[model samples]
Target: MPLAVVDAQTLVDSVALGAVYALMAVGIGLVFGVLRLVNFAYGQLVMAGAYTLAFTSHFHPAVSIAACFAVVIALSTAIDLAVFRPLRGQSPAVMLVTTFALAFLLQAVARIVDVRDGTIGEPVRVVGRLNRAVDVAGVNVRQVTILAIVLGVVMLGLLALLLGRTTIGLHMRAAAADFRTARLLGVRSDRVIGFAVFLSAVLAALVAVVLTVRRPLVTPAYGLQETIVVLVGVVVGGLDRLWTATLGGFAIGFATGLINGVLPTDKTIFLPTAVFTLVILVLLLRPGGLFAPRGAATVERV
Candidate 1:
């Protein structure tokens, strides 16, 4: 690649990568806020959404895309009701194991399906009047990555509004604070959980589309990468805070991309590995997160 080309690539990669990270992080963060347990199976939702697109693109691209997301939400909600909700009365440790088990189940199912029907790999591309370029410190940058940044901001802003302003949002916040208290106040805990599950499902859809637009073709094992990145983001951003996670996701993406652009190509893998190690170390030092100010807080019931 030309020198000029490399610069644009860095910017493009940063933004595109960041969007995917944010998508995974946000959903994980929200789910954690509600249940206070990590959904180890969360990656399956993304894989499900992407697979839907792969299967449906030829039959009906638009409809299939919608179906892809719908399926994720539906499947996750099923798990929540059938698996998580009933087990909620149990200890969080048990729920953690349950989610991990669910995750493995999803992975096994995906493998079976993949073996039964080989994927028709396809790249998703959105064509329109392209801005194509803008000078940045004497280098031209592509427009698509900037668009990714914009989309991430818009989506996150909308999510913040929904959680901050909506009635269900209030209930979630209250429940997160104190599940018992919220139930006592007539806030149906199930409904709140359902809503959390619903949003997580939707996140699956949104992430699939955004990711496909950036890099077409989905693979069966894709969810594992997403799960890892989101897990790191949540730890780095501070598990209790949404915005912090968002910021951490983007920051990690940018750092990784920039390093990839600048470092020796052979050694580039170290960027992600190092970033992940740093995130883990930071968490060990500050268990709540880099952004969270206080000690591990047990949110009081309302």
Candidate 2:
């Protein structure tokens, strides 16, 4: 294959993978920008969504997908209200560890649920994977991938509009810019913050279905990796800038998948390191993120 063709092939695959990551990263980044703390159990949200899909897929697949989305968002909101919200005034370190603990609890729940159900998790087909391919500049690519990319674009656009053009969006922006100012302006900062957390969960839930459809195979162990990717994208993109997070997720997905394909080894390793290394360099050269900073910006670009 020509060098250009080879590179292009890898890129297409990367973007397909990136669409899911972009969804995930934006969620993490959105939470961090709004509430300067990490939600370690965020991955569990995805896992929960997947398992929800797994169980429901047998009955009504469409309903299962909807249930998964609803469950994730509701669970995420519950976490904010029940756990994180109570610890609102705590140190960042405390919040981080709390979120981490939440992750463990979620995983344990998954383990117990799976054991009771007598099943091991794997990718459940969301839509029947089209074996059909459309030739894209000599590469016979799967049609599903193209469709997935289109969906990703649409979601991102909708989210952008939701954030930019809505009253809820205005409240979110006001809080993100300055919580105190937001309160002074009658924004009810606490409620505003709760909304941010709710939105975070909803976005994370959205990623769950997107990913299950894109690559359904997942185990409880997958939660850790998903958490890391979402967090990494948040960090790399500059937490405050939505586009940066989106770009960062897509960039990492592309880089990781591309490297996974090109390496001579039978198994993939070091892609996370390689991706983070690039992010670190970007941070050293341009702190905050590739985009401008907002709020306290705990999401260092590196």
Candidate 3:
């Protein structure tokens, strides 16, 4: 391919990748903003959604997608009620460890279920047709790429309105700003947290849909690596604010795509090393946050 062509394709792929990462970042950041807890089990939530899609792949695409969403949201809500709710008011460290435990537990359960039929990694082909590329202005773009970009923008806009206009959104914002004060002011913690989890789950399912189009196999740790990267992106962007966190996620993902594009195909194994090296450098330079304004006091507010 010509250098120009390669650059164009890289830009397109970067945008798509960044959009997906931003979605996941927002999901993680939302919960952290409101509850001050980083839910490490979030990848498992996406993993569960991927498996759900795999199991329901024989059905119509719409039906399978709907089932995926249902399973993820239900599982998210259950986790909150059964695990997180009881641990409420606990130290942030305790909650973080609990989430790690929950993540491992879910992954183990997935492995058991997957190996039950003597198959380790079952591939799900839900909406496989979307993987086909269509030419746009002489450039080939996968359908799912377009879908991801559109979905990310639409979801971000809707969420902005929800947080800006709705009563529930106001409560969530208040809770994020200060959980203790919000609770004292009659903002029901349960309802706010539950809604945040629900929204996160919805975003997770959407991510699964987009991801499975690119990677069809539904493995137990399917979403694990991506989650780890996005979490780092969240931190790099500033965990205290949602928009900055989203930007951070997108920035990291875009950089990854660009790096992958430029690297020799046979030596692509260095991608993670390169990415994290940049991350470390960024952190050293801006411990507060890369996207955060210079000299601005850091405040932990959503």
Per-model C-alpha lDDT, please? Answer: 0.73, 0.73, 0.89
Best by the TM-score measure? 3
Q: 210-285, model 3: which lDDT tens digit per residue? A: 9998899999999999999898898888877888889988887887777677767776787678767867776676
Using lDDT, give the best candidate's number: 3
Candidate 3 C-alpha RMSD relative to the actual structure: 2.8
TM-score of every candidate relative to the true structure: 0.84, 0.85, 0.93
**Candidate 2 structure quality by residue, lDDT tens digits, 121-197:** 65566654543578987987777678658867987898889789999888877777776778788887667777777
Once superposed on the true structure, which residue ranges of model 1 sit more than 4 Å away at CA?
1-9, 117-147, 271-273, 294-302
Q: Indicate the TM-score of model 3.
A: 0.93
Cα lDDT tens digits, model 1, 1-302, are 33434466677767777776787788887777778877888888887877777667665556876788789888988888788878876766788798888888887787777666554344343322234676666666656566667777888888889889999999988887778889999999778988988887887777776665555666666677768767777778777777776777666666667767776788665667787788868756776677777676433223
TM-score: model 1 vs. ground truth: 0.84
Error of 2 at 153 (Å): 1.3
* Clashes per candidate (backbone, < 3 Å): 0, 2, 0
